[model samples]
Target: MFNLVVEMNTQKIRKDFPVLEKGIIYMDSACVSLKPQQVVKAMNCYYNEFPACAGRSMHKLGEKVTEEVSKARKIIAKFFNAKPNEIVFTKNTTESINLVANSLGLKKGDKVITTDKEHNSNLLPWQNLAKRGIIHEIIKSNEDNTFNMDKFKEKIKGAKLVSMVHTSNLDGVTIPAEEIIKIAHEHGALVLLDAAQSVPHKEINVKKLDVDFLACSGHKMLGPSGTGILYGKYHLLEKLEPFLIGGDTVIDTTYTTAEFEKPPEKFEAGLQNYAGIIGLAEAARYLMKIGRKNISKHETELNKKITNELLKIDGIKIIGPEDPELRSGIISFNYKDADPHEIALLLDSSADIMVRSGAHCVHSWFNAHNLKGSARVSLYIYNTEEECDKLIEEINKIVEL
Candidate 1:
């Protein structure tokens, strides 16, 4: 069922995002979303009312900051169906993934399995660690940009870690996470999912999904930049070696060995983006206000029409599923002779449509599929059917040009 939140409360919800009043049709949510007024106000409040280093100072302002951070943590944990202590704030998605690659206690002989459809943030950390003597294996996706489930099962025999993107940036396809986790856990392998492209568009229950680790960027989901989050199981985080070690991360440090603070605090080293974190909390709150279920339905409703309309254009080849229900609010396509960046320029200048261009950091997918480059039109809640119509019209003009 499609959600009617946007239709039912358009006036109230649209009021929250001041940029919506400026009359620009934004279609790049997969790249980065525009922030809502509520998030802006929340960030301003942090800087104006109570801005201090959380968990460090003892003053009232500092305590207030601490309480604010704690509140955000609890809110995020509840959103992800995780425990408060299990969540950690990171600078971005890359940092969150690196935390696992650096601290997850993988041995020299340990094998980590990844997908062909991974963003660089999810793929490179472990791949770069090959110099450290860890074995990295990439499970290729099918021709349709979906995972080869049987092949995925084939690679699980010797893998110690299964790190994958829950939703792909290149194709905007959502993988079946529940099955992925179930099969991997049976092999005693820990699973790490990059939810950067899925969190805002899908209904996620990490607890029910049985994933050991998940990472997402706040900015991509209409929150402030320089903010990302990592969700780990409570016990797993307790045992993890802190990836970033410094300042507030330690209980006691000396000339000798240093003893670290517990779980999340130990993992969070130094001063964080107080304003960004607060903004993210407000963004989550705004989503909660509208109900994520409704958001998902509305997005899916738009995706179906957009995907079908786009595929009908000549020389256009979509990289992911033909069915909109199988993907999120992303459409990756390429004209026969046009470079993706060139196409993006045309779309921006001629149609005023903003999009992403290139391999989208999924180099493996491009290589396997023989794509020179691709352009992506990523949508969000604020995007409308009228903009999608314009996109299709522009695509027709580009193809005929």
Candidate 2:
């Protein structure tokens, strides 16, 4: 069923974002969401007020920074139903996946399973493991581009890790991650979910899902850039190796050997994005304030409006699931014989409609399907129904032109 459960105040929410006032209809939130005033303020608070290093400094400013950072960690952990220690701040989703890939200690003969629809962040890490003699198995999607659980079940055998994207950026399809996690565990394989898209729109309980690890970016979820997190079960973290090490990662050090700190610390080497972390915490709070359930429903409602109108236009092909409920605020499509890039540029120049038109970092999927790229319109809370109308109007104009 469609998940529109909460009542939303779109006008109020739109006010928090200044860019909405600029007359530009931003439909590329899946690429990078515009930062709200609260997030920007939080970042500014760090730089202007208490700009200092965290964890290492013993001074007052340092202590304040460390305290704010710890609180941010707790807030992020709570959102995922994870322990505070389980959250390891990384640069972005790519680094988060790379952290798991590097630390998993995969041998030449070990198997890693993923899907054909994964963004390169999730796909390439596992592919790179092949050079270490680690085998990579990719399960093909169904004809409609939906994840084929049957194929997933067939290929998960003898796999050391099953890493998958929770949501497809290329098609806006949401995978049944809980079911996938259960099946992978039954087969004695660890599961990692690339939640870069899912975390922004819905509430995810890692504990309930029983996912071994997850990676997400803050930038896509109303937080600052250079901020993201890798979450691993505490016990499993103890087993995985640290991807990067130096500075605060170690508890004790000698000229030749060093004793590393615990999981989160060991993984976070050197200086971190202190401002980004604090800003991310504020963004998390902002999302919670509005409620993820409410955000999901609102975005879904908006997506359905656009989807319904788009389907009526002749020669316009909507990608992913036919059901608007399944698309999750992202609508990617191609017009008959029209280049997606050219369409995107025209839309921008004509009406200030910002959409993403490219392989979207899932070039493997595009290449496999023998297509070039599709124009994508991704929504967020700040978008209005009026904006959706304008988008449809522009699409019609483009098609006619």
Question: Against the hidden true structure, what lDDT does model 2 obtain?
Answer: 0.91
- Candidate 1 — which residues are off by over 4 angstroms? 1-12
Flag clash pairs in model 2: 4-297, 108-133
TM-score per prediction, in order, is: 0.96, 0.98
Whole-model Cα lDDT of every candidate shown, in order? 0.85, 0.91
Task: Show the lowest summed lDDT stretch of 10 residues, model 2.
Answer: 1-10
Off by over 4 Å in 2: 1-6
Residue range 180-211, candidate 1, lDDT tens digits = 99999999999999999988777778899999
- Go through the candidates in order and give the clash count of each: 1, 2
Most lDDT-accurate candidate? 2
Residue 79 C-alpha lDDT in model 1 = 79
